[model samples]
Target: MFRAIGNEELGRGTLGHSLHMLLAEDPDFPSSTRSAVDELMRQSELDCAVRAIIIAVTSAQNPHDELEHVLRSHPALLESEWMCDIRATLREFGCFSLY
Candidate 1:
């Protein structure tokens, strides 16, 4: 399923966060499965462009456009460190989605 989702380009309509929410919601999903997704999200190659977006924001012609470009060009962006930091900061304030 991981290979299928990662390799396929079926839903331009699908949101990345929605998939994360789905995984978080699935009570039947194994811990190994969730770990796989999280591990995949942490990979450098998959997340490089998103990091580029956050880094490029000040120089970006349009910050929003650059962020969107990052998302479109690298859909893994949300699951990457950008989102992880967001999650961690939120967790510091006592809000966490993963647990």
Candidate 2:
């Protein structure tokens, strides 16, 4: 069996949080997509955090809520080695806190 996903459906169905829970048991919706979904979700979170980190690290203005959602959802990201370095660097220069 072959299924073709058109452009509109491709955009609408993948790369974001548009997936529905009911599809979990559907054979057409492969279980292997779980990692893809997690990667996309992490990408979304990373986009927010990276932009916020850039802003906070480069300017006097704090990231404020821009870092909230991602940090809340994936707190471990803060403890990652790179993030620890960023935080440590910022702290040394009296820059902003990412928390």
Each prediction's Cα lDDT score? Answer: 0.42, 0.39
lDDT of 1 by residue, 1-99 (tens): 333333222233334334534554656433434344345456654543332233333233344544454456446667676655643454455332222
Task: For each candidate, give its TM-score against the true structure.
Answer: 0.34, 0.31
lDDT of 2 by residue, 1-99 (tens): 001222232223342212323333456443233333345346665433433333334333333333333346567557545456655665566555322
Model 2: which ten-residue window has the lowest total lDDT?
Answer: 1-10
List ranges where model 1 is wrong by over 4 Å.
1-47, 81-99
Which pairs clash in model 1? Answer: none
For candidate 1, give the lDDT of residue 72: 61
Please report how far candidate 1 places residue 6 from its true position, in Å.
26
What's the number of clashes in each of the models? 0, 0
Which candidate wins on lDDT? 1
